[model samples]
Target: MPMSALRFAAVAALLGVALAPAAAQAHRSWLAPSATVLSGAQPWVTVDGAVSNTLFYADHVPMRLDGVKAVGPDGAPVAIQNGATGKYRSTFDVQLASPGTYKIANVSEGAMASYKQGGETKRWRGAVGQLATALPKDATDVQVTYSSRRVETFVTAGAPNTTALKPEGKGLELEPITHPNDLVASEKARFRLLTDGKPAAGVEVEIVLGGVRYREKGPELKVTTGADGVFEVSWPEAGLWWLEATVQGADASGARKSSGYVATLEVLPD
Candidate 1:
């Protein structure tokens, strides 16, 4: 199945085989930046967030900005300005006051559970902390799953730096072997996949370019991580690209947990 389909399937199957690979869904979520690299005393980039049937095209619902955040080169929180939601998409602006890279992300974490209460099945979804109190005290045959998801993009003011790229050591994350803002067509870019701070080998990554609305069929490229949890991609041309990956495992409490990551990157002409 296409990565788009897997996203929805993963959520619906969270209590079953959470994060299991599945077919494509009708919509895909993404974040697109107006610019990935800039030069000036202070630069800014506008980002569009949406979940559309066509990649990067706002033909569907706007992505919620409640979890959106930005981090500067110094590992300090950067402010997101002029955030707004429209009919089909959400827009936000970030100021590149510092002369280095910045990471902008929309993150969400929650737990899903199903139980039998009063001889009826009940379903619940909420933050991990609220799982305990939200569920019935006498609920039987209870099953729970935790999930984390992140959608993000990178922008550089002067030169790209890694400080903002540091992983939080939770959920699925990208560790760039090749700087995200430095991607070039025909040149290979390497990245490592991490699951709970450790290498996540055998994970599959799906790459697709934007402008699918104008094409008869969108082409998707797939790659799998090696033992080192690293994978490489050679861009076919210059444009905005969407990459996604998902992994499932167990949390500290031995409860089933899953993580999904999506990133938008720009590839420059060779």
Candidate 2:
């Protein structure tokens, strides 16, 4: 009885150990990049990483954008906004007011099924913790992160296009400039432009003196940009000349007139 009883107890214990229920674990995973930086007149941030889940069960996940912050040499939080995407991917952009330091955090609730390095599904994850680092500053060194991920990883490692908001808040105080708004006898008025205490050279200069008699000579003359982008022309007679100068391009609106600044010049009647 003693030997049989002992063997039976040993066998019973072994079966119980094998039959016990296994615990269930849930893993929340998103994505992350090694480094991110904020630079440029506007400001930008990026996250580089891969998802723990291989299946990408939730094609769509919500991400929290941070780092829209800064501190004076004293310390203060700069206000910023997390832009919206019209597609399924999650990304964020903010227009920095000035410049400083900042950070960004990303989180996901539901994760995709986990896959083995052999390209097989051995486990599944329900939750995962994913975060990205960012440094936003003005005139600062930018950090870039490079990643090597398996094609099967369910994540948007691909970067989306980024753009800056048109400069606001008294953008670039560019005072309207002017060329020599004057003219003498019918010879191009050797004129240079003026702006912000600098020569407005290399910009088109227009000379309009309507008081000239229209014989065989033209009353109005116009010149385009030359050296320094400024050109010159002559006038038939010098009097009160109506002059208009403009430099077309991206600096000022593509399609804008005068930029709301004009000048007047008097020509000696020759």
Candidate 3:
């Protein structure tokens, strides 16, 4: 190969190595709202859910709607309308009955176990309560892991409020100091990470702008929570962005558990 060809190959090899970790996590799950802020007597917002290599592109698979839910500004359960699943994405709509913010999320939790029964290894996945019956009576050397995940977005009918943004205190969640629907480009926004309702410190969060398919590389920002579980970011530009984080610890019963949180935020131009 010519000297120029050799250099190009070397660069490509290095790039691949650097991106290996990212590729492993390339399939990102998110919920995208058509509009974050709205005004009217009755306002409605449509949302799309998908798992894709590029943010909000919906190329991989549709996110299941079984775990999707919504909360009104008064902390009441809001109904999802016109929910449908397609080949690459799931679609749903929420009507803003009251003039405040609404929280829409897809939440899921489950446990996995591996054990030896009759000198054979077996694995089981289901709700934690079913472990007793799912595992054989003679099962030995059992190990169980619990996991929880939440993907969320915010929509405001008139003004944003904190009622719907309250943390459930049971899993990984985002407590926004700056309203999620009020993000502005070049302005600083602060958020806190929580695990089981308490401050989660030293957690790493990955933020990336949407429309990755249109660019050579998507712009990404990485931030870590402080001792108080707070992190700040100044938006580089105006667009839809995705933020994700994960934390691992033991649950109340002393079983290993992992929790993950993902949010899609829309930033407005300043």
User: lDDT of all predictions, in order shown?
Assistant: 0.86, 0.30, 0.84
Clash number for every model? 3, 25, 0
Give a tens-digit lDDT track for model 3, residues 72-147. 9999999999999999999999999999999999998876666777887666666768877887778888876777
Q: What does the lDDT read for residue 120 in candidate 2?
A: 30
Lowest-scoring 10 consecutive residues by lDDT in candidate 2?
147-156
lDDT of 3: 0.84
User: What's the lDDT for residue 80 in model 3?
Assistant: 96
**TM-score: the better of candidates 1 and 3:** 1
lDDT, candidate 2, 27-91, per-residue tens: 11232321223345544433322121211122333333331222221134334345443233344
Q: Which candidate number has the best lDDT?
A: 1
Q: Per-candidate TM vs. native?
A: 0.91, 0.26, 0.90
Model 2 global lDDT (CA atoms, 0 to 1): 0.30
Model 3 lowest lDDT segment of ten? 14-23
Give stretches of model 1 more than 4 Å off. 1-23, 252-254
TM-score of 1: 0.91
- Ordering by TM-score: 1, 3, 2
Number of the candidate with higher TM-score, 2 or 3: 3
Residue 24, model 2: Cα distance from true site in angstroms: 76
Candidate 1 residue lDDT tens string, 53-93: 88899998899999999999999999999999999999999
